[model samples]
Target: MNGSSALTLAGVLVLLTVVAVVIRPRGASTVDFYLAGQRVGVATNAWAICGDYFSAASFLGVAAAVYATGLDGAWYAVGFAAGFVPVLLFVAAPLRRFGEFSIPDFLGRRLGSEKVRLVAVGVVQVVILSYLVPQAVGSGITWELLVGSGLLGLSPYATGILVSTAVVAGLVAFGGMRGTTWTQAVQFLLLLGALVWLAATVVGEGFHYGDAVADLSRAPLENPAPDGGLTSEQNALHPEEPAIFGQPGARYGGLGQFALIVTLALGTAGLPHVMNRYFTSPTGAAARTTTVWVLCLAGIFYSLAVMLGTAAREIVPTAVDDHPWLADLTVDGVLQVPEHALPVLGRIYGGDAGLGVVAAGALIAVMSTIAGLLLAAAASWGHDVYERHINPRATQRQAVLAGRVTTLVTACAAAGLGLALRPETFATATASIVATMVTWAFAIAGSALTPVFLLTIWWRRTTAAAAVAGMATGMLVAVAMFTAGLFAAGGLLREALVTPTLVAAPLAAAVTVLVSLRTTAPADVEKSWLIMHGTAADRHAERLAQLVLDENRRRRAGRRARRARG
Candidate 1:
């Protein structure tokens, strides 16, 4: 890494640490630590939500995917943004209305069963840990490329993972939801700004977006594998073999394409960290509006990302002859590591300053997302498990302390796993290792939590027993299929099993419905539905009633003082 780039990257991290210190939550209440005192506004929360959702995968992998494959690569962004539609339609409002500390907390209370909460907690941890490892790994990869050296007697990769994990985890532990929210909001703006700056530079430097896509589409899409030579099934499926900028069959086959889309779309409705952010909204309506804003922001961010990828494809072949680093990583004029597509573009178009901005955005992407994941981890294991089960009578201070401890422990575990990986895996493919780990978390969350969550909120007949049974069935089946798929040879069966939500989700929903039919409903099932479906006006009324009760207590206290004076 160049001195200018290292200084820029280090400045951003220092600024974030200052932000964390400034906004860190105070007091020992769980409310302050866990949900930011439930006062986050729609715009602020929306940005934070974007920061949480757009991990290293979105910032790097999407563009890389597009750079390598003509039209098929854009699916990553499309499927990811599509997920919020389900969140807005089915989950955002209801989930906020039915809110607790986290997903598991909501489930446990809604079903009137601790067992259901425990099951949800386990599933959520699996999702969080799976997601956290990649963010950590991505941090290491970014550090190696942008900073080029390690500190504290460690390898660059190890230093990257440990430092990022420690800093973000400490932010969460100290500032909790409040500190992370503001930091994430800022991080997201930085990310969007980086994309916009790079886009403007590339376009201004004589790259026409439409012409680039049009020209690339006319030829058969080549695989951007490190070793090369994978056939384009997309071209074979259609005899004309016309170049299209937005067609299927680059990395995934026809069915594989649909499966990936469905999994990603449905998966958003169940992600632990994403939904946990909703709980920090001031009202259910705030959460709903936040989703709308997220859609807009994501649409803008991802469209730019795809365009950048297109620019890289058009610009890199010639630029490689000029930059020695580019030539070393390229195989036959195509980059061996697709993720380098953007950084190379930055150096080619905007020089060292541009490279620094893109590199900082990557680190921000990893750290900001990790903040939300660690917070969610604390909510599940610390608030939901340690406080609820182990110390039911624990004080508020004790509860918050538990959350802090969990944050540190979870961060360490994920960082250690990240240090074990080879950074090359994250840099090369369209379906890079970082992206794949995120997909596994998504697939598992979709199978185990989404069906039961939707049913609990919208279906009146969803019993606690049914929720538990359905969750168990989903998790077991997903794992079994995932294991089998790993062992199977590459083909349609492998593709379907590797990303198995299309099948697993339906099976989970079926099991939930069948079990619900045979079981007795909770005594307050109707009341739960009312809470889940309550309007904004109803929530206003509830808050107004609480205000009246507080006023009444003040008047009574005033009268008691008068009597004492007499």
Candidate 2:
């Protein structure tokens, strides 16, 4: 391990801990613990959401994908950014208007069924766990590369999984939503700064993006073979042609591309952690406004990630001449693992210090996302399950304790799963393993939740029974297809199986519609609709806040006048 890099990583973690402790909640109130008292401003919530949303997948996997697969890999960024657009248009305002601690809470209340709530809780857990494990794996990968040292006799990768999970879980347990919010916002800024610094350094080093792409396209893409050597990649889409670095057929083909995009695009609305953040907005309008800022910021962030990925592809090969250390990480001129693209680029550009910055950003990315996921899990278990079912009359303190306990348990489970995966064995399994794993979470979310979520928000006749059927069907179908994808041949069939959102989402929607048509609508449908879609509540809240501000200003003025007269 490099001392400078280790020091930088330690410093970043220390800063995060300080922020969490300083901003931790002061009360045992569930509102404060779960939703930050619903007072988060638009700008702050936007940044927190970006922090939560831009996981290791966005920071490491997106760049890695681009470096490995060229243009086709860029679809990850496009699909990710586009996912928020639907949230801006359909989910943001209405979700906050009908506010609750978690997605299960909202759906349970909306459908007026204990059964629906339980089913939603289960689905949310599945989505959260799927998303959480990949983040833990990403932490392990980053740690193995960054520090290369282990504690307690564990491997470097295992140590990272346990340490990051434990640290972030403890922070979430103590800090709750309020603390998590501020820290996430700050962490996002650090992440963005690191990316910007890396990009600037690359460009300053005389790396022209257009020239790089053109030059790479002239030669076939190569990667590390199974025996730890270089081999030319054959185009999956057009086997007759060489897999070029600037072309489309390197990673995905026609069907695979469409399926992957659909999975990511529809997944954002159903991500329990991301959707949970919306509940922190003071008003539905604020939630909508926050989404606008998120889109702008995400665009800038992903564009930089793509550029850096290209920079790594072009610069790293030539860099081996100067940095002999890189010879082990690369086969010939090609990187063995795509996930190393950004971190390697940082080291190339700024030496050990640069690597530390990029590595810290990556760890922060994993931790921030893990924090959000844990909170979401806590809300699902403590609020939706325990408070609503096991102990209806529980006190505020009891509820908060339950949430904390749930956070720890969930974190442990994710860490355990990460350790089981043993990423080192599959280091050559895919170009961007983190991205691939995250896509599974997206596929599940899109298939099982997104369709039903949209229908419940927009369709007044949606019933609890319909929701249960939709979620169960969507989830089962998607998981089954994903399992089938494991042994399926590599082609359009595997693409459809692996990324089944294209099929599963529509099937879920159709089932929901059919079941709803056959069943009677909920008795309080009109009331729920008004709560979800009307603007009167938002207007009244804004007016009350304005009056409070004005009253405080008047009191201040009067006090100043009296002091001057005295």
Candidate 3:
């Protein structure tokens, strides 16, 4: 990308941050900062969820996975999209109805124990930090490639980390959820539009999708290996045979595929940033309906992602032929940096200008996700730790101040870790470094939080002590297993450790049940059940959602009409 384009993108991001801060509600209360005042319409919230959910992992990693592993890579997108299904079925309405400011708040109130709340706060922080590091990594990667220079004498990577971190932290800390929500919704549209345009450009120009899939399937999936050579690749997918792109065992063998999918599917509900989004909905039913819209948007977005991945695989050699500068980066017609599959594809097709557009999308993906995660972190600290523990007598302004400070701190910490760690890619993951870390976060959340979260809502007998035990068990086991897995010799055991949801989640549920059976149930079991699953409550929520969706549609149509007349 040229300096002019780079500066333009920087200006755009700065303008967005300014707009977010400016639009924040004046004299914003704690509610506005933490939960967007609980008045977000269904459509708007759904868009924001899409923005929040599709981070660097979905934007760059999914395509890179396909670029690296063919059909096996498609599972990342599939698993991500599938996760919302469980959210709709088990978590959304009930959790929203419970109406706590944060996950710790809900668990603490429901189980009637400060212990439960504090324990959950630990798990939530782990999840938030795990998720935050990758966004920082993605930002640094984008800046290094797109801008290609350090800013203000910092290393390119550090500059990228600090610049994106500071901007997003400011947006969330100052603007809060109300500001972040609108900004996120707009960012999602920008990301979706960029991907759609890239897909259209590639497929429209005489690229036969069917033929590409057929060819990629017949060729064995291979990745570059370091053997002191320019081009030496080992089979990373389906090593025994030349794998088909659309078939199974192409990327993951044994039970690794199933474990990865289960982790992703269950993890969505456990994600603090994601679940917190439901709390922004105007009502329980609106939250539920917003989930439905999330599913629809996810499906559309992932399908396009799948196409882009396939297109990149088929286009790489041609791209190299068009741009000889990639000779050093592309070995045997495959990009060594799998994460570059999308932006490099853009660089191949449209020169520097094309690269700027796609790279901008990647940067936007990173920052938007950072904004959501920081807000969730703020809620975790400001609401769960500060208001509930440190300063029970604090006023609304004080709470917002706490949240804002926490946001800035979290951003700085995450950025520091991102630069310091710079985790190398795992051999068997067949995903980007950013994406692999995200999977670990998902596994931890799904294992540690989802099981307890669901049982707390669906099972009346769930006790505070049991919920606490289950979460602690899940957190320790998942973290221990993943850390061990990182150093273990590769095989089924390594895969299991890498994606521990299958084992961790069930163990947590079992512990919860056994403890609950031994202990007394939550005192408000009957009332909690009524709040979680009452028929009248569902009806009331659905009616309110219909009104919001109807109004949103009318306003959207009015804007379209006004644009057409102009």
* TM-scores for candidates 1 onward, in order: 0.91, 0.94, 0.91
| Candidate 3 residue-wise lDDT, 36-130, digit = tens | 88999999899899989999999988887887777667888888999999999889998998798888889999888998998998999899999
Winner of 1 and 2 under TM-score: 2
Q: What's the best-to-worst order under TM-score?
A: 2, 3, 1
Q: Tell me the TM-score of model 1.
A: 0.91
lDDT of 2: 0.90
lDDT of 1 by residue, 1-566 (tens): 45676547656654764575476546579988889898989999999999999998899878877886656778778888999999999999988888798999998888899999998999898889888988987888777777778998898888889888898888889888888888899888888888888999888889898889777777666544445644343442353564344556566777767887787888888899999999999778889999999999999988988999889887887787777777666766676666777777877766776678787888889989999999999999888899989999999999999999999999999998898888565444334666666777788888888999899888888888999988888777777776687677656887788778888888999999999999988888766776789666775676788799999999999999999999
Candidates 1 and 3 compared: the better one by lDDT is 3
Candidate RMSDs in Å, in order, are: 5.0, 8.3, 10.7
Residue pairs in collision within model 2: none
Q: Which residue pairs come into collision in candidate 1?
A: 217-243
